[model samples]
Target: MRLLLASLILLVFIPLNAQTTRKYSNEFMNIGVDAAALGQSNAVVARSNDVNAGYWNPAGLINLEDNQLALMHSSYFANIANYDYAGFAMPLDDNSAFGVSLIRFAVDDILDTTQLIDEQGNVNYDRISLFSTADYGLTVSYSRNLPIQGLSYGVNAKIIRRIIGDFASSWGVGLDAAIQFETDNNWKFGVMARDITTTYNSWSINEEEFAKVQNAVEGQNQELPETTEITIPKLQIGVAKLYRFHYDYTLEAEIDLNVRFEQNNDVISTSFASINPAFGFEFGYIDMIYLRGGMGNFQNELQIDNSEQLTFQPTFGVGFKYNGIQVDYAFTDIGDQSVALYSNVFSLKLDFSIFR
Candidate 1:
């Protein structure tokens, strides 16, 4: 009971110190994968138990009893962008495990208008071209059970790459660590430190092309500059509980709170107004079929006058498992009024130990 009380206190107190800011970089890394987790509004820090744990909370990988592989694909942001993830986990022993995952988010075939005009100020249709923008990350993760019962820890080392067609590219490396505790009475707590190394992306531009472009518009007051970006650290805390009923039915509820520390106007500080919280619920029958719903991005709107804030978004998902294989689907609202606001995600997971 004391643990429950502590969890409640944390949920309420953490966001009070959150302040809003917009100086952080690498926003694409914040896009979550896994249909099941997304369906639950990404409140999986304490509830992740499958291969997807490598991306959500690596410590959760300790709960897996078998080797597993999972893949996910989604049509994001007005259905014009593609986001995909793949993860695999292998248990080394009863107390340790290793995992790896890859993520790619891309927008393809975007029209390049920079070179569409000729020197005579006439539009050259033949000069029009297409290019792509992509972000990729490869993560290697490890997890192990601690000497203390019900406690576990994990870490993920990641290599990140971003490309703007062939014009510019950047590379970065980062680390993430997580710890989780599950009590005997079905309560779970999790904390994760993301980008512990303050991932830095050093960009390199094509100099010859860049100079020509600079000379092309020398008097027009337009210029492109190469710069480095740093991804600030984000901390996440989560709590969850599960209940089981007769006939193999189970229900679960989870909540996650996030805080980001970054340089706001050249001074490093925590943005108290940027505190985001997510909530999720799941129902399952005999571990075969599952239903989930959640809400996310609640920016501490506790007052009545601020009831119409746009921070909250609804998410839903469903899953089916049979013969060691699971397929899941999720739908998310991207916070827009148009039909494009809705995005669809699909995922498949395979457990290989079941066959062996």
Candidate 2:
């Protein structure tokens, strides 16, 4: 455990200059997965205990005494995009566990007008084509319970791939480390380092595929170029406490703070501002039914001008469990960044004890 902690510190603080111009490569990996976590505004780093913990805080896997499988689907931007996730976890020994998960995000049937040209001067609709863009990730995780009664540590290795209509593609890999602690009084704390080794995506472009577009436009001399982008490391901290009440009811409240390290290109700002905070609450009855709500993406008033406004994305969800099976549904307001649309996520999970 001591060696693991030392390694995590070194991985996070290693000196690597980040690219200033290229930002957010393979961003699909940042999108939160699973209805249960998204419903809590992604504030479950401290409370995650299901198979989805492989994506949230891998250290939470130590809390799982049973083998579990989880599957989720979410529609974004009013059905324009689809995001899916699947994960499985199993206890490897009395004090250690392993998990694997896959994520896919895709946008299909986009009209490709780059080749819309004909011998005649008139535009030809028949020349138009349709294409799709997709991103995929695979994560392998392992967790071990420390000698301390309530402390656990975990690590994840992830591979990412992206494809754009058969014209371009990219591949990358990264690492994540996490630690969690729970007290006998029902208080939990967690810390996670995302992209601890820094993620790098090397893009390969096929310039020949865009010859038609270059020919159709006058004075167009641009060509696709191979490039690489780096994703800076991010740190997340969370704390939660659970309250038990009469009638077999329990309530949990949590808050998370996320800090991202990257360049601030705004000429007006003197330094980088990369802090984001979120809050979530959940209520459960008989440990079978749950209600959840949360909010995230908050910025200080000083960060915005008169022309710009801050928007808070709110989320709500519900869950049901019966006979070792669980189903969850979540609704989120995606705001107007792209399209004014709401997102709905649904997930199913099954659990069975390995020892039994």
- In model 2, the runs with Cα more than 4 Å from the true position are 1-21, 263-273, 300-310, 336-339, 353-356
Q: Compose the digit string of candidate 1's lDDT tens values, residues 218-312.
A: 46433444356678888888999999999699999999887776423211235452467788999999999999999876532335875533446
Q: Poorest 10 consecutive residues of model 2 by lDDT?
A: 6-15
C-alpha lDDT of all candidate models, in order? 0.80, 0.79
Angstrom error of the Cα, residue 230, model 2: value is 1.2
**lDDT of predicted model 1:** 0.80
For 1-356, candidate 2 gives per-residue lDDT tens digits of 32233233223312244332355565678888778788889898998877888999999998887899999999876677789999999889889999999999987777666556677766888987777777899999999999999999999999999877656778899999999999999999999899998888887766666455456445745444436767778888999999999969999999998777753422122345477788888999998999999988664333335454455668899999888888999988765223467888899999985225
CA shift at 290, candidate 1, in angstroms? Answer: 0.6
Which residue pairs collide, candidate 1? 17-272, 18-271, 18-272, 18-273, 19-271, 19-272, 19-273, 19-274, 20-273
Error of 1 at 198 (Å): 0.9
Q: Candidate 1: where are CA atoms >4 Å away?
A: 1-23, 211-219, 262-273, 300-310, 336-340
TM-score of 2: 0.87
Q: What TM-score fits each model?
A: 0.85, 0.87
